[model samples]
Every structure is written in C-alpha cells, then in structure tokens.
Target: MGKIIFYEDRNFQGRSYECSSECSDLTSFFHRCNSIRVESGNWILYENPNYRGHQYYLSKGEYPDFQQWMGFNDSIRSCRISPQHQGSFRIKVYEREDFRGQMMEFTEDCPNVYERFRYHDIHSCHVLDGYWMFYEEPNYRGHQYYLRPEEYKRYTDWGAMNPKIGSFRRLHYFQ
Candidate 1:
C-alpha cells in the first residue's frame, strides 16, 4: 500500500492528513495543502475536488511547499495514487486529432518533442504500456498530465487545453 501525508502549512506545519487511497474531496481534512510527503507510491494531486482542474504528479519524496511539486497554488482538493508499473513502457504520439497525422512510438523519455518528432504539437496519443506523464515544456517542466494505458483521440482527451506537448516520460515507481 501507498502512504501520503498532506500538510496545511508550508514546511509540514499546521494540521495534517494521511491518505493511502484515492480521495475525491479533501476539504474536510484541511482547507488548503501547502506541503506534502509521499512515503510510498506515486500520486497525482488535483487543484479542485472530484479530480477536476490542474494536476500535479508527485513521486516518493518530500515537498516542503506547493511550488516544489509545481503547483500553481496551495489549494489541493483531491488526490489519486498511481498504480505501480513493473513492465516495459510504450506510447504512440500523433500530430493530428483522431490519430491521423505523423506518428512516432516511444519507449523512453522524450525531453523535447520537436527534437525527436519534428513537431511541437501532439494532437492524440496511444498509451500502449505503462503510465506516462505529458509536460507542457521541455525537460519535464510546466503543466503535467498523467496518462494511463488508453487511446486519446484528441488533446482534450488528455485534459490538456492545447495540443502543445513539449515533453513526455514514462512513470516509474521508486521505492
């Protein structure tokens, strides 16, 4: 099982809440989340309740403040534990919606999509194996989107407001 702790203040002060499973709404436990500690598995923290809004992917580590996890603010209303994947990773990216344009398959991290695919936008994708994280900028920076094994027919299908995908990486669980 995975374990995670949420702190209401930066530097792990104030009230706190421990969670081992998915939580749709965390308002009752705390008004805000300024810090977090992921002791076990990977996790995805949401800016709004019910898993809606911005997402922040976190691995096993200590986040002394929201910014450490690239959070836009201190508000974290929901969270979900990412299942561990022990197998190989595979993913296919498309340059247009509905999987119709140029395509490329990736088994490892891509720090710059344009450098590898010669394209700045990924309109669709197919996660054939393992989980992946899509970033809005190169080097795994900017907005993040967690994708599991599935077919995304459009950029919106991955919860991205735009088709710009600067980088992507396979999610690997760390002990």
Candidate 2:
C-alpha cells in the first residue's frame, strides 16, 4: 500500500492527514494543503473536492511546498492513488476529437511530440496498456493529465484544459 501525508502548512507543519486510498473530500481533515509527502506509489492531487479542477501528478517523493507540485494555491481537496499498470505502456494520440484524423501509437515515452509525431494538438487518446502522463508543453513541463488504461474520446473527456499537448511520459510503477 501507498502512504501519503498532507500538511496544512508548508514544510510539513500544522494539522495533517495520512491517506492510503482515494479521498473525495479532504476538508474534514485539514482546511488547506500547503505541503505533501508521498512515501509510496504515484498519486494525483486535485485542487477541488470530488476530483475536480486543476490536478498535480506526483510520484514517490517529497514536496515541501505546494509549488513543488505546481499547485496554484493551497487548496488541495482530494487525491487518488494510481493503480499499478501491468505489462507494457502503450498509447495512441489522435489529431481530431473522437479518435479521428491522423494517429500515432507509442510504446516508449515521448518527451517532445513535435520531434517525433510532429503533432501539436492531441484531441483524443487511447491508453491501451499502461499509465501515462501528458504534458501541456514540451520537455514534460506545464499542465498534466494522468491517463490509465482507458479511452479518452475528446480532450475534455480527459479533463484537459485544452487540446494542445506537447509531451508525454510513462508512469513509473513503485515496487
């Protein structure tokens, strides 16, 4: 099992909560999350309750401040541990919504989509094998989306702020 601790203040001070599973509403434990410590497994932290709003994907690491996770503010209301994906990591990106237009399938991680696929906007995607993180900018920077073994027929279907995607990385499983 994974262990995650949420702190109400930066540097892991103040009230805190330890979670090993999905939490829809973390407000009952703490008013705000200024810091976090991920001892095991990869997780997705949401800015609002019910897994809505901006999200930050974190692995087994330490985040002494909210900015370390690229959070806009100290409002972290929910979190979910990503399940370990078995076998190989495979994904398909489409240039149009509903999995239409030119497509590219990848088993290895793509740091810059333009360098390889030459696609600027990923309107849809299909995660066929493993978990992956899509970035809004090149070199694995900017907004991110954690995709599992599922199908995202549209950009909005995957909770992306826009259809423009520049890079992607396969999630590393914690053993």
Candidate 3:
C-alpha cells in the first residue's frame, strides 16, 4: 500500500490530509497543498481534480515546499499511487518524432544522455519494461516526465513542449 500526506503549510504545518488510495478531488480535504510527505510508495500528483492538468511524479520522501516536488504552484488537486513494476528496465529514445532517426536503448539510469548517445534531445521513446523518469536537466534535475511500460511517439506524448532531455532514471519498487 501507498501512504502520503498533503499539508496546507510548509514544513508539514496547518491543515493536512493523509491519503492511501486514489483521490479524484482533494478540494474537500484542503484548499491547497504547500508541502507533502510520502512515507510509502510513489505517487503522481495532479494539478487539477480527476487527475487532469499537469502531473508531478514523487517518490518516497519529504517535500518541504512545492518547489521540491517541481510544482509550478501549490495546487495539488488529486493524486494516485504508481503501480510497481516487476520486470526489467528497458527503454529506447529516438532523435526524431514517431520513433524515427537515431535511437538508443537503456536498461539503467543515464545521468547524461549526451555522453552515451552523443545527442542532447529526445523526440520520441519506447519503454519496454518498468517505469522511467526523464529529466530536462542532467543528474536528474529540472522537469520530470514519468513513463511506464508504453510507447511515446513524440515529446508531446510525454507532456513535454520541446525535446530537450538531458537524463533519465528508473523507478524501483520498494517492496
């Protein structure tokens, strides 16, 4: 099971709500979320209700502020735990859209794709197994894109405006 807590104030103060399951609408629980604590399992926090709007993927940790979760603002309206993957990690990135152009496959985390693939952008990708997180900056920083075992024919398919990907990391199941 997954466990998470949303706080109305930073440092886990003020009104708060604990969630162990999916929540379609969090308005009833709190007006806004400024901080969060994930005690177990990874979760995808949505900007709007019903899992709409932008998504912020979070692992087990404490986010003292919205920026820690890479949130544009303190407005988390919904959340859902990420399902654990039992298979090996496998992913392929393409230099062009629709899975075209040069390609690179990875079974482990890549801190800098440029070093390995000699590229700086990823237009498309295919995840064959496990979950992955694409970072806009190197060393797992900046905007994050959470990917499951699926196909993303273009950067837009993964909710990105441009194809500037610098690194990627795999999500591991805690239990």
Candidate 4:
C-alpha cells in the first residue's frame, strides 16, 4: 500500500492517503490500514460509494483523537493538485488546474506519464508495475473498494478464495 498527494488548490488543504499494490484499477487496500504518521482508524473510507475505476489503499495523518485526526484529513484534503498515483508511497500534491478529469501527470513542465484515478474529488488511484490500486481520498475515511491479484483470483478462481455465488461461481471455478 502507498499514499498519494492531493489538493484542490494552493489555499486548499492537502492530505496524504494510503495505497495498496494489491489493489489495481478496480479495488485495493483493506479496511484496517496502518499509518506512519496519523494513528489511522477514524471512520469509513470514502464518504460515498459512487466509484468507478480500480481501487487501491490511501492514507494520511495520525492523531491521538479520532475526531481530531479526521479533522486534519478534512482540512488538508481540500488542496488542489491532489497527488494521484498507483503505488505504496505518499505522493506530492499537484498544482492547480491539474484536476482536469481523473488524472495527474508526473511531469512538471510536461509529464511523460500521467497517473489516472477513479476520482480526484475524493478517491485516489495508483499504478504499480502494470497494475492499479484505488483508494479513498482524505486521510480520515476508510476504504470503499479495492482491486488486486487476490480479488482477481477470487473472481477467476485461481488462488483458493474463489468467493462467488450461483452458476457464475461454477463457471469461473472451472475456468
């Protein structure tokens, strides 16, 4: 898992988020995430669930008080140039006018590669080694979705879990 930098504007707040290499494109990151700075465990990640793209882990700040930590996340997440990437490390926030859609490029003058995200408004995305990890925005919230090899396994019935239902489960299990 890693973190991405995100901000709506310069005056806007900026916050770090957790990320997971496990999740990519569709989903990633678990519920109980560990933070290096903030204590973690504030509330559910992502205020809403109208998400698309892959999911990964995202994290930010830690505090003794849950409410306080949440407040801090809320405060910093408002900044523009919200850093959005796919990895297991916190990224730097982008500059204003960066949030064109659901992407954040790496080049300052001209980024060779731009990291795509599910949504810059709140959720973040990261790409690692040809994979993607989706994560909720702001440090305080918890997780909404995740995409990873394991989940793929479950969906495809390759590595055990094979968690599915009905005839589709049998069809996937066979495949």
Candidate 5:
C-alpha cells in the first residue's frame, strides 16, 4: 500500500501528493487522503515510493537521484522537472529511465567558444537529431530545441542530419 500526504494551510486549503507505487497508472498512486495531514517534517519520507517509506529532511540545496526525482514527478503528476545547477544534480550520474516515454539526445558544440558563436565562417552547431542546426551561440534558446531524429534533415540540413540525428523531436507542452 502506498502513502498519501496532504499539506494543509492555515486558510483551510490543502495540497495533495503521493509517492511512487507498484501500480502502473497515475490515479491509483495518488491517493486522496484529505484528512491526513503531514507537517513540514521528513518523519514520513520513504525510500521506495511505494514499498519502503523513510522520512528525510532536505534543505535548500539538496538533490534526489533519478528514482526519487521520478517518484516526486509521479507523485505530483506533473510535467516539469526542475533543473539544479550545482552540487549532485549538475554532475552526471548513470540513471535508469525505463519507465519514460521518449528520450531526447542533445550534442553540445566543441571548442567552447564555438558553442557560443563561430568565428570567420563556422557557426555554432548543435545536433539534436539527424540534422545539425546552426546557431549564433550555444544555449541558443536557453530552452531545449526539440526535433525529430528521422525528419531532421527535412527541416534544415539533410545529408549529415540523418546520421547525426538518429530520431528525436522537440517536445513542447502541446506535444
């Protein structure tokens, strides 16, 4: 059995969320236990979202691993994943993402500065899928540029894009 927690405010309004579970879908996992109130403490935190519950106290700069991240994502049933810049999150760690739907592959520009702006003739290049798109600098959009790997060349360049972008598409809220 999974646990559900409700955070209540002085206004009598409350927010609800839950942890991961063996169950497949969203509804079964986020139990609506409105009457159950959990204060600002980790005495109820857990390891496995569903099975083992271990409460933990995380301060401002803490970061959870991929599983915990996914568990939080699932419990909230949200599409947003907050990106952390420093500490544990900024560092790359091997993670299992078998439950995710589609994966995005991104390649950064080389020569550092080339990542920002190219000199003479070369432009900043980033290959997200089959095709490579030229930008004035790296972090071109500051937002992720999604593209379909198969149809990459069709958009800008085709020849090298095929091999470059295997098959990935930009993911938007609508898509």
Candidate 6:
C-alpha cells in the first residue's frame, strides 16, 4: 500500500486530505493542492479532474510547495499510485509517428535523450518492462508523462502535446 497527503496551503498547512489509492476527483476533499507529502510509493498527480491536463510524477518525499513538484498551478484534482516495479526496465523510442523512423532501445535512465539518441523528438514509444516518465526538457525537467508497459503509437497516446522528449527515466520506488 501507499500513503500520500495533500495540503491546501503551502508548507503542509491548512486543510489536508490523505489518500492511499487512486482518486479521480479530489475536488470534494480540497479545493486546491499547494503542498504534498508522499510517505510511501510513487504517484502521478493530475492538474484536472478525471486525470486530465498536466501531470506531475512524485515519489517518496516532501513537496513544501506546488513549485517544488514543478507544478504550474495549485490545481491538483486527480491522482494515481504507480505500481512498484522490482524488475528490469525497457523502452524503445521512435523518431516518427506510428513507430516509424529512427529507433533506440533503453533499459536505463537517460538524463538527456538528445545526448544518446541524437534527437530531441520522440514521436512514439514502447514500454516493454516497467513504468517510465517522459520529460519535456533534459535532466528530467519540464512537463512529465507517466507511461506503463504498453505501446504509445503517437505523442498524444501518452498525453503529450508535442513530440519533443528531452529526457526519460524509469519509475521506481524511492529509498
């Protein structure tokens, strides 16, 4: 099981809500989320209800403010716990839509995709082993996208607005 707490004010002040599982709509519990504390497990926080809009990937840690998690705002309306993966991680990145064009396979974290793949745009991907997080900028900064073991035939398949992928890393439990 996993534990996470959402705070309505920064530094864990104000009204708060504790969650152990997936929540499709957090609006009933709190109007906004300014801070968060992940006591266990990994999670993905969504900006809009029903798991839409921007996404923020978080592991066991404390986020004193929304910006600490790289949030664009305090609107965290949904969340889902990422299942722990104890095995290896594997993913294949493609340069064009529908799994076309140049391709590269990765089993380890890539802080800068362009440094290894020689391109910043990854249009499609196949997650073959474990959960992964795609970032819009190098060094795992900017927008985040959570991906499970599946096929993403296009950028939109993984909820990305564009094909620009700067960095990527496997999602694992934090010590």
Model 4 C-alpha lDDT per residue in residues 1-175, reported as the tens digit of each score = 2333223222223333443222222122222222223232211233223332222222444333223323323222111111233333322222222222334422121111122322233222222222222223332132223332222212221111222111100000000
User: RMSD of candidate 5 to the true fold?
Assistant: 15.3
Query: Cα lDDT of all candidates, in order?
Result: 0.94, 0.89, 0.90, 0.25, 0.25, 0.94
lDDT of 2 by residue, 1-175 (tens): 7889999999999998999999999989999888899999889988889988787898888899989998889998988998887679889999999999999999998989988877789999999998898888899988888788889999987788789888998987775
lDDT tens string, model 1, 1-175? 7899999999999999999999999999999899999999889988889887788998899999999999999999999999989899999999999998899999999999999999999999999999999999999999999899999999998888999989999999887
lDDT string, candidate 5, 2-52, tens digits: 233432222224554443222223343343222232222212232333312
Models 1 onward score TM values of: 0.97, 0.95, 0.89, 0.19, 0.19, 0.97
By TM-score, how accurate is candidate 6?
A: 0.97
Q: Write the residue-wise lDDT of candidate 3 on 125-168 in tens digits.
A: 99998899888889988777778888999998877778999999
Candidate 6 per-residue C-alpha lDDT over 2-50 given as tens digits, one digit per residue, 9 for 90 to 100 = 8999999999999999999999999999998999999998899999998
Candidate achieving higher TM-score, 3 or 5 = 3
Worst 10 residues of 5 by lDDT: 87-96
Candidate 1: 10-residue stretch with minimal lDDT: 45-54
Model 4 error, position 35 (Å): 9.2
Off by over 4 Å in 3: 50-54
List the candidate 6 regions with Cα displacement exceeding 4 Å.
none
Question: Which residue pairs in candidate 2 collide?
Answer: none
Q: For each candidate, C-alpha RMSD in Å?
A: 0.9, 1.2, 1.9, 17.4, 15.3, 1.0
Model 6 Cα shift for residue 102 (angstroms): 0.8
